[model samples]
Target: MSNYTVKIKNSAKSDLRKIKHSYLKKSFLEIVETLKNDPYKITQSFEKLEPKYLERYSRRINHQHRVVYTVDDRNKEVLILSAWSHYD
Candidate 1:
């Protein structure tokens, strides 16, 4: 069983379906699985957004894509807010 739970917002779900590349989609899914274990632990390209997005965080899916989320420490849940190509 996973230590933390991951929940995707409706907007993020829509964004996920818009990914056109299968390989990219697969990679994003893999990262999300890891997020279920610990959203704050994936430091490769993860960043806590600045003042404008306080309490929210982002992890790179690739050079162009990103997964934005927020962590609820009290409940041990990771709420996925968005998944989209940064340049889009």
Candidate 2:
């Protein structure tokens, strides 16, 4: 089991900075760590995107917020595209 390197986009970093709640922020970071180990395991709140474009996946940070990312298996990298409230 190889670990993946997680990279956050500039837009995603902007979104993360906008997170006001402490718990949501913590959970989001935790989820990112989990992705480093395994980004393909799908649970209730963690799954691949519907269209499956670019091997993208979504992991919930909380009820409203989620982390959107794409997996690069060959390079073992996870690129975070967004980390913000989905409903917002």
Cα deviation at 59, candidate 2, in Å, is: 0.6
Model 1 residue runs over 4 Å out of place are none
Q: Compared with the true structure, what per-residue lDDT tens digits does model 1 show for residues 1-88?
A: 7878989898777787876555687878777887888888857888888875479888888898888889888999999898887577
For candidate 1, report its TM-score: 0.85
**TM-score, cand. 2 vs. native:** 0.85
TM per prediction: 0.85, 0.85
Residue pairs clashing in model 2 are none
Global lDDT of model 1: 0.82
Whole-model lDDT values for every prediction: 0.82, 0.82
lDDT string, candidate 2, 1-88, tens digits: 5499999898777887776455676787778778988998767788777787667789888778888999888898999999887677
Residue 87, model 1, lDDT: 78
**Model 2 residue 48 CA deviation in Å:** 1.4
